[model samples]
Target: MTQTQNTTHGGPDALGVPAWDFSSNANACGPCPTALAAVQQADASLYPDPTYAALREAIAAFHAVDAGRIVLAGSASEFIGRVSAWTAREGGRRAWWPAQAYGDYAQAAQAWRLERTDDPAQADLAWLCEPASPLGGAEQQAHQVVGSALQVVLDRAYEPLRLRGVCSLDPVAQNHVWQLWTPNKALGLTGVRGAYAIAPEHALTEARALEQLAPSWPLGAHAVAMLDAWLSSAAQDWLTHSLPTLREWKRELCAMLEDLGWTVTPSDANFFCATPPHRLNAMALRSHGVKLRDATSLGLPGQFRLSAQAPEAQVALRRALIAQKERVA
Candidate 1:
């Protein structure tokens, strides 16, 4: 079966794109004006620099890291596969990740034939996602694995959108694990697929190995523009300003869900998991152009994840839920 068939995700288009989508955890206040303008101005007619020298430099400067430490990928999913393959090539035989996480981690490990292990110390490679997917909470045992000899990659996709709490790792701890970043989600431009990883400090050999595995020109002009724009003062400012709004929206959304008899879990990011008092006909809701991510694939059965969206979207969701209930009645 194809990958789509094998794995389910929040932002599926098979049911037609939802009008009030609460499935994807993208910034509700974005695409940031500056970032969107940059993407629009991208000169798609010409091929981006084959080596992505300038792109790498822009990303490196944003993260305050050496240019050599920046490894580009088409997207987070692409990086997961490439990195898993790299681990396999380097004689990695076992992988460990949170019981709840982005599905690509497991899919990549399985594709590379790495045995799955629950214990982080026993695994050749470990994956950690702070403000993790579905749950939007801190990674468990994150502090214990820091500075370990075992290869670890910390997915920081949600770090930019974090509304509360700090990352578990300090600067010294952060230097030991690969920091994977995808700016599109935070930019509210998830369609613009591009991502990068900051290699562990002093790991020039591992950095070169990842680069060699990457296909030529992994990032196209638009992606390059998005990543570059992501570093702009205006873009950063916009993101910083949007957090308060998202925090308010998240508060109201959670309260509304709780009123509807759903148990809302606390989260650090702009999304949270909830279990309704009654089983929901998610497909029925989707037919009405309202979509919520089923958390089952993320190891939380009978619960759904909803991204913090505009007030109007929340109203639409409440109406849709009530309508679905009426239809079932």
Candidate 2:
């Protein structure tokens, strides 16, 4: 293992929850009622089936994949670390990920001492994320990267919340790489930590290795309930219906940033990156109970990732921005 520092994240911080926060990529319209109710009603008194037989079957049916191909994880981050460790343990020496991606990818690589390489062809493992984080743009080189790497994992954490554009990878290409899905963010239930990965076709050996590496009952009852709810027609319908509202909110967010003379980057997801007209006083904003995700940690300095929020939250953010500007002036 390698020495590492704590990674920065966007949710509630040491100051506690911000009054208006645009730091995390969670669905602003979420904690979907259906999913929430399922979690609330889950039987916490009992441990879920050790094998998660029924839950795995349900998720597999939803994706139209074999039950044996489903790999349950405590969360997406947990899977990242496990897979990276698997790569290193299998005599894999190098890894690669998107230019801008979740920090955990790199952190996992470091922990496994996998040499970081910019060229996917030279790597034993490669990671991809569509509507890539911090930038929220399509991964243009996905095909090349997926084709080159010996083992690949595509993070689809934001797919359900995608407001525009389609997945860059077609079904055929997708089958060549692992598809990691974290429905908690989309269900608006980030507190419910659960995720699943679809093993690439004929990759049973590797899939079993991952399953063997996992501790028993990786998902708790609440997580199992939440994920089950996510596959329901009611929850799926709710998600589809929420998109238009999110699109409108995103429009308002972009317009507000543009009006403030901030450069907003176009994105297909609910979140996008923006650069303030002046230097951002993040601490001052936090003091005012407002927070934005600083993109510096994600290799995109001078930009902040802002998720589309409701009108009231947007208004609060605008006022905070104006106040911070005046304070700096």
Q: Which candidate is the best by TM-score?
A: 2
Over the stretch 231-324, how does candidate 1's per-residue lDDT look in tens digits? 8999999999999999999999999989988999999999999999898878777777788888888899889889999999999999999898
> What's each prediction's TM-score?
0.96, 0.97
Model 2 misses residue 223 by how many Å?
0.6
Candidate 2, lDDT over the whole model: 0.90
Cα-based lDDT for every prediction: 0.89, 0.90
Worst 10 residues of 1 by lDDT: 1-10
Quote the positional error of residue 17 for candidate 2 in Å.
1.1
| Local lDDT at 201 for model 2 | 89
Model 1 CA deviation exceeding 4 Å by range: 1-7, 147-149
